[model samples]
Target: MAGKILISGGSGLIGTRLSEMLIDQGYEVAHLSRDPDKFSHYKTFRWDIQNSSIDENAITYADYIIHLAGAGLAEEKWTKERKREILRSRVDSTQLLLDGLRQHEHHVKGFVSASAIGIYGNSGDQLMSEESSYGEDFMAEVCKAWEAAVWQIKDLGIRTVILRTGIALSDKGGALPQMARPVKLMAGAPLGSGKQYMSWIHIDDLCRLYIRAIEDTTFAGVYNAVAPHPVTNQEFTEALAEAMHKPLVLPKVPSFALNLMLGEMSDVVLSGQRVSANKVLQTGFTFEYNYLDEALESFYKKHQN
Candidate 1:
C-alpha cells in the first residue's frame, strides 16, 4: 500500500502546496480543516482545533501525521485575546492529536509538526542554528510552547520532527506579496533600519523539506526550513523592487512608525534573525531557489504580467 499522510492546517499556504505536492508524489493525502467544503481536494476532513475535536477516523491506518494547524501569527493585531488564540491554536491542536495517538496506540511511522524560527527571538547579527538559545520575545515564547506541545508524541515511541520555518516567500498569500504591494506602488521601501536579517525559504523548498522529513527515517529532531542564503531587509527590498522593475529610491519605514501603526506586531516587521539551513542541507535536501533574487524573480514571473 502507498503511504497515507494526515495533514493539519492543509488549507493554509504551506499546507495547501504540501498537500498537492504529496499527491503528485503518489502518497495518500488527507487534510484536516475546519470547513472541508471550502477546498475541492477529495482528501480533506473537518477538525475543530479550537474545540479539541478531531475526526479520529481520518488517521486510522495512516503512515504519518504532518501537523501544520495554527493561528497565523501575522494575520491580526497582537491583542491580548488574539495572542492567546495564536498560542492555543497550535498547542491545543497538537495536544488533541497526541491524545488521539495515545488512545489508538497505533504504530504511525512519524509525526511531523510545524514550528517557526521566531523562537530565536531578535538575534541582531547572530546566525542561528538548531543549537542556538531561544530569544526573549513574545514569538519566542509561543514557539517554545508550540514545540513543547509536539514533544508529547515522543513518549509514544513515534518519530516526531519539528520544522522551525522561516519567512516563506511566495506570490500567493504570503509575506512576499504583501511586501511587494507597497513596492509595486512606488511607495515600497525597507522596514526599520533595514539591517535585520530575513531568513526565508521559497515555498517550494519548504514543502520538500517536510516531505523529506516524513520519508527519511534518519531525519529526526528539528530542522530550520529556510534558504541557505539569508539577506538583510534592505537587500530584500532592493531585490524585490528590481524584480518588479520599479525604482528603489523610497525611504524606509522607521521602526518607531511601524510600532505606532502595528503595536506589538511591529516586532515581527522590525526584527528578524538569521537562521541556518545547513542541517537540512546536510541531510541531502537541495533548495531549488537559494538566493533571494532568484526566488523573487520566480515570483515576479508567475504573478507579474
Candidate 2:
C-alpha cells in the first residue's frame, strides 16, 4: 500500500514524525506549506489558505491526503479575532483542499483528517465515543465546522477517516512536556478538580492510527484516538511525577485561579472528556501504550537516555 502521501501541517510535531515513519515504510511523502523553503527535505507545495490557493500539483500527486493544518486552539486568547482565525484555519484550509481535489484531475484514494476530542467537550465521567453527542463550547464548534468541511470530500467519493484525537502525550511536543516541567521542579499539582478524566494517547500510537486509517480500506468515518484507559487529572499527575522521579509538593491548582489566568481558555484544562478508544481498537488497531504509567515511563526513559 505504498504510494505518494500529501500532508498538510507536515511541519507540526505529529506530521514530522509521521513523514519519517511513512518514508521508512517506502511511501513518498510531500508537504503542503505556506513557505516551501521551511520543508526542504520533503517535496513542498505552496498553499495559502487565507488567499484560497494551492498548488494543483500537490493535489494530483497524491494517493492519500492527511489534513492536519489548523490553528492551535490553546495558543492564543480566544478573542473575537482569534476565534475567527481558529475557525477559518480549519474550515478554510479544508475547503482549499476540497476545491483542489475537485478542480484537478487526480486519483486520491483516501483522505485522513485530524480532529480533536474536544468535539465531545467536558463530558465529565461519561465515556465519549465517536457517536456521542457534540458539545456546545467554542472548541466543539470549531471541530464541528472542521469535520463538516472534511465530509464534503467524502461526498466527492473519496474514502475519508476522521480521528477525533485526545490529548497526545509526547516528550518532543504537545501536552506532556508542559505538564512534566512543573513536576520536575517539585511544584507539580493537579489542575482544576483533579478529578476530571484525561483521555490521552502516546504520540507514536496516534501516528500509527493515522497510518492505519490510510492503509486500511475498511476504516471510514470517525474514531477516537486515545488510550484504552483514561485516568483522572490526579492520577496522571502522580504518574508523571513518578516517571521523572519527582515529588509533588504543591496543592491542586484551583479552577478559579485558572479562570483568572486564562479566561475562557481555562476550560481546556479545567474540564475534560472521558473519551473511548474502543472504536479504533475494534478496527483491529492495537495501542502500544494503553496505560498512563507505561506511556509516561516510555517518554521519560527516552529523555534519560
Candidate 3:
C-alpha cells in the first residue's frame, strides 16, 4: 500500500494537502507539473497537455496515478474560449495520460481520478447516485467527457476509481472561504433559490477518500464524494453564519442578478445537485465531517472574529 504515487495537479488545494498526507504516511510522492522546476520540494515530472506530450519517466515512476488536473470552472466567465479550455484541460490532459501509460511499460496498479457531481446537472430535489442519469448542461457535458477519458485507462487492465465529488469545503481555499467571506461581512445570503440543495464534503474527508481509493483494490467505478446530509442554501448560509459568529442581514441573492453578473457560468451557483454518498459509504469509507454545522465549525470556530 505504500509505494510511489504520481499526482497530476499536485499544487492544487486538494493535491497540496493530499501530498502532505501521503508523504507523512511514508509513501514516495512526485508531482506531474507543467513546470517541474517550479516545485522543488518533491520529484517533479513535466507534461504539456496542449502539445500532447508527457514525460515517459512520469509514467514509469508511479505505482499509482491520481488525476486532478483541470481548468478552474468558476475562475472565469464561460466565454467560448474558456469553455473550450475547460473541456480540453480535462479531456485532453486525461487522454495524454492515457496515451503515455499505453506507450510506456510500467506497473501502474490503479488510477484514481477526480470527477464532479455536475454530471447530474441541476438535479433539483431528487437525490443523485452513481446510477442517476446525466444532465444536459455544459458542466455535465464536461464531466461526462472527462470521466469517459478516465475510464479508457481501465482498458490497460488497471483498477480505476472516479469520485464524482461535490463542493469540497476547505478553510485554506476552495468554497468555504468565499462562502464565509460574505457571512463575516454581514452580507451573507443564499444564492438563487434558498431551497437549492448544496451537497458538500469537508476537504479532509475528501482527501481521505482519495487515499482510500489508492489503497483499496476493490474500489472501482464511480462514487459520490459528498456528505451524508446535504443542506439547502438557506440552511448552509445559516450554519456558516453561526459558525463564523456572524449575522445574515441580507436577503437571498437573486438568480437573475447572478446570471447577469456571471453570464452562463451562473449555473454553477444557481443550480444545485443533491448527490448521495451512500455508494462510497457502502464501501466502508466513513466521513469525519458529515454534517454542515460540524464541518463549518471545524474551520471557523477557532478563528471567528
Candidate 4:
C-alpha cells in the first residue's frame, strides 16, 4: 500500500521525521511547501492557501495526504489577532487543499490530518479518549474547527483519519527542547501544581502512527495519539532531570506567575488531560518508547556523540 505520500507542513517538527520514515519505507514522498527550495530531501511543491493555488500535480501524485499544516499555538502570546491566526491557519489551509483537489484530477486514497488532544481542553486528571466530551476553551474550539474542516475531505470520497495528537517529545524542536533547556541550567522546576497529567508520545511512535493511518484502510475517523501511561508534571520533570543527571531544586512555578507571563497560553502547560492511546493500540500498533525515561534516554544518547 506504500505509494506516493504528499505532506503539508512537511518542514515542521513531525513532518520532517515522518517524511524521512516514509521515504525509508520506499514510499515516494513529496512536500507541499510555500517555497519549493526549502526542502532538499523530497520534491517540494508550491502551494498558496490565500490565493487558493497549489501545484495541482502534487495532489494528482498522492496516494495518501498527511495534513500537518498549522501555526504554532503556544509559540506566541495569544492576542486577539493571534487567536484568529491560530484558528484560521488550520481551517483555511484545509479549505485550500479541498479547493485544489476539487480542481485537479487526483487519485488520492486516504487523508490523515493532525489534530490535538487539546480538543478535550484542560480537564485536570480526567482520562480522555477519542470519544471524550469536548471542553470549552480556545484550544478545544480551534481543534473543533480544525477537525471539522478535515472531515470535509471525506466528502470527496477519500477515507479520512483525524489524530488527536498530544505533546510529542523530541529533542528536535518541540516542547522537549524548551523543557530540557531549563533543566540543563539547573533552574528546573515542576510547572504549576505539578499534578497536571501530561499525555505524551515519543516522536518515533508518532511517526509510526502516521504511517499506520496511511496503510490501514479501516483507520477512519478520530484517534488519540498519546502514550498509554501518562505522567504528572512532577513525574515528568523529575524523569527529565534524572535523565540529564540533574536535580530539581526549585519549587513548582506558581500558576499566577505563569499566567502573568504567558497569559492564556499558560493554561496549555498549567492544565492537562490524561489522554488514552487505547484506540491506536486496538489496531495492533506497538509503541517503542512508551515511558518517559526510556524515550529520553534514547533522545539524549543519540545526540551525545
Candidate 5:
C-alpha cells in the first residue's frame, strides 16, 4: 500500500470507481459521508456540511484528500431551493473540509478536487482551455464558486490540483448510460443543433488522472480533464449508434421540445464547449481513449453481454 487517501463524496459515479482503482493500486482509501455505516467495506467518516461538522479522524488518517462532493446538476428542475442546494453542496462541503483541517493539526500531502466544464457555459464551438473566460450562467457560477472553495487549500501550503472535468463516460452510471439507452432502442438522434462540442473522457482514463495527481508531485494547478479530441452531439450520437450496431434514423431532437421538458437543465445537453486537454498532456499525461468512437466502442463492448 502507498499513502492513505481520503475522499469526500466518495460514493458518487467517479469517486466509487476512483476508490476502487486506488485500492487496486495498493493505496488505502476511505470516504467522508453523512452516514458512515452505509459503506461497510471501507473506513467511513461522517460529515454533516449544513451542521459544519466533520469527523476528526477522517482528517488525521489521511495522507492525501480528493474532493468530489456536489449535488447532481441535472437530476431535477432548477427551483430557487434546488439552485441553493446545488451550489451549497459543493461550496459548503469544501468549506467543511477546510474547517475540519483547521480543527486538527494534520500533515496532508496533497488535495485534488473535481471541477466541471460547465464553467464555460454554452460556448458553442469555441475551444475552451483552462484560461478561457467564465460563462455567465447558473451552472457556470456554481462551478466558479466550487473551485474557489478548493483554492483555499493552497494557503495551507499543500500542493492542490483542480481538474475542470468534462462529460465523464462510464458504463457503470453516468451520461453514457443515459445517452446510450435511446440509441440502443433505435430512437437516438442529434440533440438540439448538435453543433455544441462535447469534450469527454473515459472513466478509466479519468481514474488514472486522479491516481497521477496523488503520485505526481508536479501535478498542481488547474487542467481540463478531457480527451484531446472533442466531438459534436451529432457525431457523438452517430458514433454511439455505430458502437451498439444500431442505425440512427430519428431526426434531431428539437431545441424547443428539450427546453420545454428539461427547463434550465436542457442547456446541459444542448450546449457545450470544446475543452482542451493540452495542459494535462503537456504534463506528460496520456488518455487511454482519445477518440469518441473508440471510447463508445469500449463501453458498449464491455456491456453488450
Candidate 6:
C-alpha cells in the first residue's frame, strides 16, 4: 500500500522536487499552498500561516507531513522588516501544521522538515555536527525557532526528522544558478575570503534524504544533510568555472563589499561553517552525487542540453 503524504511549501524548489519524486515512488502526495491552482499532481489547500487556518481535509488524511515552507533567506536585504518575515514565515507555518495535527483527526505517522547549517553560524575551522552548539546570530535564532516549532509534532508521538541542510546545488532555482550565471559568462569569482567552507549537497541527494526519512521508520532526530566532502568557497567557484569550461580569472569578492551590499544577510555569503552528513550516512543512506566537481559537471551538462 502506498503512503499518503502532505507537504507544505510544495511550490518551492526542494518541495516541488521532493513531491514529484515521492509521486514517482508511488506515494499519494497532497500540497498545502497559499495558491492552489499552480500544480495539478497534488491536491492544493489554502492556508494562511499567520492566521493558522489550514484546510481541514488536507490535515485529516495523511500518513506523513514534510514541512518546507519558509521565506528565501537570500531574496532580500536583511532589514528589520525582512527579518521578521523570515522568522514569521517559518514559525507560523510550522505552528499551523502543529495546530492542525493537534486539533484535526489525522493519522500522521511521521514528520519531516527542512532546516539549515546556518544554525551553526561561522565555525571558522571547526567541524560542526548535530551536537554542536547553536550560533548566536540572526540565522541561528531563526533555525533554532524553526526546529523548535517542528519538534512540537514529536510530542504528539509522531516520528520526526529534521534535515539541517547545507547549500543545495542544482540548476533548478538555487544558489547554484546564481553562481553559475557569472561563471558561464566567464566572470566567475570567489566570494569573501574564499576560505569559508561551504557545506553542500546535490539536490537529488537532499530529496532522497527526505524520502529516506519518511520510508525509514527508525530515522529520527536531526541529520546534517550535506555532502561528505565540504569545499571552500574558492573550490566551489573553481569547480563551477571548470564545469562551465571557463577560466577563473576574477579576484575574490571582498568581505566588506558583501557586507555593505547584503547588510546583516552578508553573514550567509561571507561566513560559512563546515558540516558533516555522518549521521544521515549512518542511517544507511547513499549519496548519488557526493563530490562537488562531479555534481557541478552533471548540473552543467544538464543545463547545456
Report the C-alpha lDDT of model 4 over 53-139, residue by residue, as the tens digit.
Answer: 788888888888999999987689999999998999899999999887788889999999999999999899889988889989999
lDDT score of model 5? 0.91
User: Which stretches of model 1 miss by more than 4 angstroms?
Assistant: 37-39, 303-305
TM-score of 2: 0.98
Candidate 5 stretches greater than 4 Å from native: 303-305
- lDDT ranking, high to low: 2, 3, 4, 5, 6, 1
Candidate 2 residue spans exceeding 4 A from truth:
none
lDDT of each: 0.89, 0.92, 0.92, 0.91, 0.91, 0.90
lDDT tens readout by residue for model 1, 1-305: 45999988887899889988999999988888788778466577778876778777776757899999888877889999999999899899999998888777465889999999999999988999999999889999999999999998988889989999999987888798889888888999899999999999999999999999988999999999999999999999999999999997789889889999899999988888999989999999999999999988987866556
Candidate closer to the true structure by lDDT (higher is better), 4 or 6: 4
True-vs-predicted CA distance for residue 263, candidate 4, Å: 1.6
- Ranking 2 against 4 by lDDT, winner: 2
TM-scores, all candidates, are: 0.96, 0.98, 0.98, 0.97, 0.98, 0.97
How many angstroms is residue 195 displaced in model 6 relative to the true structure, after the best TM-score fit? 0.2
lDDT of the structure predicted as candidate 3: 0.92
Clashes of each: 0, 0, 0, 0, 0, 0
Global fold similarity of model 4 (TM-score): 0.97
lDDT per residue as tens, model 3, 1-305:
69999999889888998999999988999998888877368999999998999999999999999999999887889999999999999999999999999999999999999999999999999999899999999999999999999999999899999989899998888878888888888999999889888999998899899999999899999999999999998999999988887889999999999899999998888789998889999999989998999998888778745
- Give candidate 2's error at residue 215 in angstroms: 0.6
Backbone clashes in candidate 3 total: 0
Better of 1 and 3 by TM-score: 3
